[model samples]
Structure formats: C-alpha cells, structure tokens
Target: MTDQALPRVVDQATWQHELDALRVREKAATRELDAIAAQRRRLPMVALPDYTLTGADGPVRLVDLFDDRQQLITYHHMWFPDAEWQCGGCTSFTAQFTRLEFLAPYDARFVVVTQGPIGEALAYKEKVGNKMDWYSTADSPFGADMGAGPGEGFAVNVFLRDGDTVHRTWHTDGRGTEQLTHTFALVDLLPYGRQEEWQDSPPGWPKTSTYSKWPGSEDVAAAYGPQGVSA
Candidate 1:
C-alpha cells in the first residue's frame, strides 16, 4: 500500500477522536522509555584503565576526557587508516552532535573516539561540522576493550568518574545507536518513515541501502552554507 492508501483524510471530529486514542499509547510509550532508562541506570559498571588518545592539542589520557565533569560520553566513530572513506553511518550519527552547548546543563563531557591520527579524525569532524571533542585512539586499547568487534562498529560508551577512578556504566551498538540521532527518531515519525530498505516502510515508499552515504568536507562546507561549516 502507498501513503495515499493509508491515513485517509478525516473530518475534524474524527481526526481528534483518533488522535486522542493514539495519545493514550504515546503516553504509555513515554512511561516505558522512562522505565527502561531507570533500569539502565541500575546496571553494574566496569572499571576502565586509563587509555591514551590523541587530540588536536596533543595526547591525553582517558580520564582527561571527563573534562572535570563526573560523566564522560564517547561515540565510537568507525574509521581505519587503510580505508579511504569514513563510515557514513558514523558520520550520520556524529552529525547531530554539532550543537555542543546543548549538553552543558547535563554536566557531562561528550567526545568521539576514532582509530586514526588526529588529523584524519579532524577531517571527518570537519565534514560533519562537529563541535564536540574528537579523539584518536590509534595507539590505544580503548577500541579493543569497548568498541564493536568487526567492520568498524559504531558504538557509544558511557563512563562515570569517581575521584581517580573511571567506570564504564553503559555500552551499546547497532540499533541501540538510534538513541542518539534525532534524524532517525524524526524520520520514524514521517509518513514514508526512514525511507531505508531495512525499515518496514509502505510498498511504494523510497528505499535505499546507502542511508549512511557521507559527503566530503568540501561538500559539507558548501551545503551547510554557514554557522557550522566553513570553507
């Protein structure tokens, strides 16, 4: 079925009636999301050793990523030196973090960790117009310990700091990565949905396997037009 076949046009009263019914389900879903977060907060954490990573300024330890904050949020952006292209999926996820100030009130430091030189990581960051801290774990065991096992995993690992010790409280990859990208969440609400082949979209809806196709830095600078990306 196509979009025209679904969600038939309705009068004001009928629309309101259907919306009111869906509101009940929406509220229940919100509560369930809250409960899941509560359960996540209660999960056991693992102590992590201090690992070295390269930043624009220079080398820094893992604890340094906390930036004096109690919590550290890291995105495991998949990038290997041998590959010519950055992972488009990672770029799509990293693109949403351009607004670095939004997380300030939460009292946590956010960063992206990758497996390349600082310059290479910076190139990818430049392409995405990223503002959050970007780090390179080329010579570190960080990825081996916390990252996705093969094919350059896109993952997020949350750490909590207590004095001199840091513990990994949560780590997730694959579909769990959806929790970050607003694009994914917003697209899910649209009539055509994500418009990706894997999604359960309507029969005639657009579908592509290249959902993560990333553009080059110059392309982003041209497309962004201002604010974040600059030539």
Candidate 2:
C-alpha cells in the first residue's frame, strides 16, 4: 500500500477523540434512517390486479407469493434474453441473500421474480446457487406493472395481502436496494469504502470506476459451478 493511502498515525487519545466525533454523526444518520422508515410505513398502498406468475410448479397468483404470510418482499431480477449471462449487479446483489427464515417471524416472505422464462430463471438460480424461491413474469404484466419491465432494470418491491386481495405497498431501485445487502454495508466500513470513484474517500486512497470491483457473471458462475452451492 502507498504511504498516502494510510490514515495519519496519532496518539491513542487523539484517535479516540476523532472516532468519538465521527460516532456522533453516525448516530444522527441512524436516527434519520429510522425517521425515513417511519414515513415509509405511513405511505399509502395500491391494490393490484390478479396477475399470474409462473413458478416451478405451473402458474401462481401474486397473493400466493406471500405463502400465507401477511406481507411479501420480492426482488425483481433483471433478465437479458439469449444473453450468455445476466446482470452482474443484480446477480451479486441477489446472491447476498441466502437464508431468509428470519422474515417468517415478521409475517413476511421473500422471493425473486424475473422477466425471463421459468425454465431459464430456475436454471440460472441453480447455476448461481441461489436458495430463494423464484418465479417468472414473462407471460404476465407483473414485471411491467411493477417497474421492472424488459430492459428497464432491477427493483425491490413489497406487497401486503388482505384476505384474497393483494396491494402494492412499496418499491425501490438503484441504490435504494443497498439496504438489503450486507456486502455494501461491510465494504463501506473499510478504509477504501468500496474504492469507487463515486465515494468521497480520503485523498490518495485507491479508487476505480464505479462498481468496477463487483464480481462479473462469469466469476459467479465459476465460483458456484454448474450446480454447486455457494461457499
């Protein structure tokens, strides 16, 4: 590592003082996030049509995705037909989530919905070693209606089940989905902070093109093998 990349060395007292100052801002940011979540909870929802999505076992209704749970969270995975691989960002983002049994206590179920065919989607999921339940919206308007139409992009959506009725509660895309992944959160704690050009890191710290460090589809494919699970 270059000398310029290192943080300035200081006495223990000075280090603690600087850290304490930073902690104050961090705490404030945490509270601000809580406030924003409160607002999200208060946001109104829209009732959705009875769109049917394709699962491994034939057709399934939108409300069926809840799996008897009151709430549901779905990751709208991006798909490129006839492409050798899928979106690297979407692949890496979705890979971070393995076991989601924790959501059961909250009365919620998490799954993936893609714009690809069910057979292809399931094959990709197997190749990537993803364990989450996946469904395809290729024949339905579900993807377009949920802002994840063909070539549009990836997104995270939330829904509420009221008896047989389903309502769209919330949706987010871009960096908004970062909160769902621990990879970015842990990387942000490093000195380089993703080492991306967009980050406001200390001068002289190593930097590269935005998301340049994210693993590619081939890398993921090789790591997991044709049918191997992620290590």
Candidate 3:
C-alpha cells in the first residue's frame, strides 16, 4: 500500500487525543439516536386490514405473522418475478439476520415478506440459505400497502398485534434501512469506508461507483452454499 492510502502516523498521545475527541461526538450521536427511538415509540399507529399472505404452510393471516408475539418486524424483500436472480441489496441485507430468537424474549418476532410467489420465494430463500421465515404477498395487497409493491423497492415495517387485529407502527425504506446491516457498519470503520463514490473520503483513497462492489445473489449463494446462508 502507498503512503497516501494510509492514515498519517502520529505519536500515541496525539492519536489518543484525536480519538477521545471523536468519541465525544460519537457518544453524542448515540444519545441523539436513543432520543429519536424514544420519539418513534410514541408515534401513533394505523390499523391494517387482515391481509392474507402465503407461507410454507399455505395462506396465513397477517395477524398470525407475529407467531403470538405482541410485536412484529417484517423486512419487505424486493423481488423480480420470473428472474433467475433477485435483488442483491435485499438479499445481502436480509441475510445478515441469521438468528432472531433473541427478539422472542423481547416479545417480538422478525420475518420476511416478499412480492414473489410462495413456491419461488421459498426456493430462492433456500438457495441463499436464509433462516428467517418468509411469506409471499403475491396474491394480496400487502406488498403494495407496505410500499414494496411489484417492481418497487424494499422496505422494513413494524407492526403491533392486538388479539386478531393488527396495526402498522413504523415503516422505513432506502438508506434508512442501513442501520439493520452490520456489513456497512464494519466497512465504515475502515479508512476507505465503503469505497463508494458518494462517500466523503480523503484524496488518493480508493473509490468506486456506488454499490458496484456489493455482493450479488450469486456471490451470496456461493459464500453461504445451498441451504447454508445463515439468515
């Protein structure tokens, strides 16, 4: 590596001083995020229709998606009908969540809802080795209602269950979903960040087109193996 590609060397004390200053801002940002979450919790919710989604076991009501839990978080995976491969961003994002049993103790459950048909959705899920329970909204208005309609983009939704009734408490899409992925988080810790063109990086740092280096479906499948993708 060239010297221009690396951070300038400094004495230990100087390095510690810079890091301490950054830590103050980092802690402040953390507190701001916590405050935002607190505000999110107080936001009102809207009631939802009892939409039916197709699962491995066949038609299942949206209310049942919670699996008896009071709260549910669903990732609306993007789909390209009849295509050989699917959205790599969606695949990679959803793949990070391998085990969500931890949410069970918090009285919540996480699942995936896609615009593809049940059979094809399950097949793709298996091919990528995802472990999260997946359902299809192909036959229902659920995907459209959730802002992930056919040919559209991906989304993350939050819901609350009251007996047989359900309410949508939160929804986010686009870059807002970045917080759910560790890949970006870890990469951002590096000197070059994601290497995406849009990132603000020092001169001489390597950069590429946005998402040009993101793993594709084939890459994910190869890494995880058939029926081995953790999430």
Q: Which prediction has the highest lDDT against the true structure?
A: 3
Model 3, span 1-231: residue lDDT tens: 555577789999999999999999999999999999999999999999899999999999999899899999999999998998899998888877888989988999999999999999999998887779999999999999999999999999999998999999999999999888899889989878899888888888998999999999888887674744333
Which residue ranges in model 2 land beyond 4 Å of their true spot? 1-4, 226-231
> If scored against the real structure, what TM-score would every candidate get?
0.85, 0.96, 0.96
From the highest TM-score down, the ranking of the candidates is: 3, 2, 1
User: Residues 165-231, candidate 1, lDDT per residue (tens digit)?
Assistant: 8999998888887877787677678876765677776666667665543455445545542444342
- lDDT to native, each model: 0.76, 0.90, 0.91
Give the alpha carbon lDDT tens digit for every residue of 1-231 in model 2: 656568889999999999999999999999999999999999999999999999999999998989999999999999999887899998877776778999999999999999999999999888776778999999999999999998889999999999999999999999899899899899989877899898788889999998789998777766764644445
Candidate 2, residue 27: Cα displacement in angstroms equals 0.4
C-alpha RMSD in Å of predicted model 1 compared with the true structure: 3.3
List clash counts for every candidate, in order.
0, 0, 3
